[model samples]
Target chain A: MFKATVNITLRDSILDPQGKATHHALQNLGLNQISKVRIGKLVELNIDADTEEEARSIAEDACTQLLANAVVEDYEITIHKKQTVS
Target chain B: MSTTFGIIVFPGSNCDHDAFYALDEVMGMETKFIWHKDTDLSGIDVIVIPGGFSYGDYLRSGAIARFSPIMNEVEKAANEGVPIIGICNGFQILLEANLLPGAMMHNQQLRFVCKNVFIRCETTDSIFTRGLNKDQVLDIPVSHGEGNYFISEDGLKELQDHDQIAFRYCDEHGELTPEANFNGSVDHIAGILNRKGNILGLMPHPERAVEPLLGSSDGRIFFESLLNRVVGA
Candidate 1:
């Protein structure tokens, strides 16, 4: 079994108001070294695929079809193998 | 000749009745309430997707609602060049359905803006704006948190080249200024039309403004303009 984690972030060209406000709040806390901040989302899926490639393909379909909106967001997928305990 | 208007009622849609009142009561048109799960759209000449939070605005505004069964028919109707109007949340749904271009983001001020504002008619080429003069200013009320419209540079250029922009946020005197763009939309766009000019997506609540007691009656004129087109044709 493989677990797929998808990280969805607003495209670089898109504005992230929530992230901007957070950045401002951080600045007030004296985090001057922070150049910028952007917000995104994380989605995890557990698939029963034998191969990592099969699990990745399924995750990719989910992201493109529903998980992430291509117009404003981009997504990255990471796979991890789960250990079986029997 | 009468026009039959279908108001799609999605879960959590609060403005369905507003569209009903304006169409069925005020204009005396045959208005039908279409449930979200229903896929049939036959006999409906005009479709109005009203505003309000759908699916609790989960994930994103209009993201979940776009998958509603009725949207399949709505998509088919759009492809056939049927006239469709999406107001507020409905606009967001249309964007998600790919019936319209661009996407909505949180307001630049990081707050919900609910107030009366002026929108200058950008183009009179669309059926929705047929009754208005070019650059005419209409007083409308906008109530939303994620009404900031965003599009890529290439997409923005396409909209410009096609004259798909229907309305722009503007001052009372019809001046497009930074302060006038309360939501900080790109190019101060408040409403837009599809390339074929058959669909309109706007953040302003025209149904709410239809009655004078509610506020401005310019919204009444907006509906009347559409009525004139659909019926007149």
Candidate 2:
């Protein structure tokens, strides 16, 4: 078994209302040094695959097909090998 | 021949009944409520993707609903010259389904704006607005938190060059001003048409105003006109 993690976020050109709101709240708390804030989503998937490469490929397909919307968001996929107990 | 409509009812779609009433009762066209899992669209002259949060608006407004079984049939019908109108949430789904370009984001004010809005008809070449002349303004109801439409600069130019824009948010007097753009959509776009003009995705709820008793009846003429186009063909 393998685990895949996908991170999806609004494209930079698109405005992030939630991110801006959080940034404003941070500024109100005197966190002035922060340059920018953007929000994103994390999606995890468990795959039955033989190798790390196959797991990563499946994860990417999942991200493109369902986890992320190409029009408004971009995504990255990471895979982890699951350790089984003997 | 009377035009029959198929209103796709995805789980959590609240506007399915409204669309049925608008097209069936008000417009006098035959209408059916098609379940999301159904794929057959035989005898349906047109299909409507109504407003409301389908699939609880999860994973984006219309994202998950795009995968519903009926979508394949919807696409087949669309390619066969069947007119399809997606209102509000339906519009979002059309975008997610890749039937239309661009995406929707939260309103610029970050709130669910529910009120009467003015829209100027941009093109009468399409079936949905065949009766309205260019620059004609209609008062329609808009209620959504994610109606702010966005597109890349190049894609926007393509839409404009092809006159694919169907309607634009405007003032009551038909002026295109910043104050008139309620959702902050690029180019004040309130609705758009596909390249072939057989598909329309609009954020406003025309069904909500199909009767004088319901605030305004301008939406009545809009649907009435669309039906005429379908019937007259």
Candidate 3:
């Protein structure tokens, strides 16, 4: 089994209203040092596969098809082999 | 005097009956309730997506509901210019379905809000609001947690260029006031129409305020507007 961690975020040019609101709040709270803020999602998945390549493909497919919106969002996947006890 | 409309009801949908009653009883139109698993769109002139937590709002609001079987038919119908209105959760579903542009994120306050708001009509050319003026104020109620709409700056410009903005926030006196902008939407947008001007997705619940008994009947115009279009056509 392998674990895949996916990070999804809106394209840089897209306006993230949530992030903008947070930035405003931070500025109001006297945190003028922080100029920009963007919000994204971290999704984790467990896949039982024979090869790392197969696991990576599955993760990519999930991200492209359902896990993320390609128009406004982009995603990256990191796969790690799960340690099994003897 | 009766027109048939279908309300797509997912498992967690709680406002299906409210939508049905509002259209049938208040708007004097025939209504049908369709399940999400059904892949049929026959004998329906209008398709409504009522407000509710579909699939327990998992993996983002309206994300799971977008993959439902019935949504396939809804997309086809919407492309053919069938009038479709997605309210609250329905709006999220529409966004997930890609029938409408942009996305809905959590409110700025990161809280669920339920309150009455005033929205100004931004466009009168769509079939949904055929006779309404471009600047009419509508006192409606909104209830949702992820009702904040987000889009790219170019996307916003495109929507404005296409005249697809269906509604904007406005004061009680029908003035383009800043305070009416609830949830911190860009350009004070409250609701919007698609490029074709047939599909509309808004966070406000028109079904919840269709009768005077509900203390506000301002939302009735939305139903009345669509009904008049169908009847006239």
Clashes of each: 0, 0, 0
Instruction: Give the Å shift of residue A31 in candidate 3.
Output: 12
> After aligning candidate 2 to the native by TM-score, how far in Å is the CA of B52 from where it should be?
1.1
lDDT of 3 by residue, B96-214 (tens): 88898888867766778898988888888998888677788888998988877887788899999999888887788877666676676778777889998889998888899888888
Model 3, stretches more than 4 Å misplaced? A9-40, A48-50, A70-73, A82-86
Please give the RMSD of candidate 3 to the true structure.
3.2
Report the C-alpha lDDT of model 1 over A1-86, residue by residue, as the tens digit: 78889999999988888899999999999998998999999988888887889999999998987888898899999998774633
- Provide the DockQ value for model 3: 0.30
RMSD of each: 1.3, 1.3, 3.2
DockQ of prediction 2: 0.71
Q: Which stretches of candidate 2 lie over 4 Å from their true place?
A: none
Where does model 1 exceed 4 Å of error?
Answer: A83-86
* Candidate achieving higher lDDT, 2 or 3: 2
lDDT, candidate 2, B1-233, per-residue tens = 66789999999899899888887898878899999999799999999999999999888999999999999999998899899999999999999998999999999878899999999999998988998888999999999999999999999999999889999999999999998897889999999999999999999999999999989999988987797788888
TM-score of chain B of each: 0.99, 0.98, 0.96
Under CAPRI classification, how is model 1 graded?
A: medium
- Taken over the whole model, the C-alpha lDDT of each candidate is 0.93, 0.91, 0.86
Best by lDDT: 1
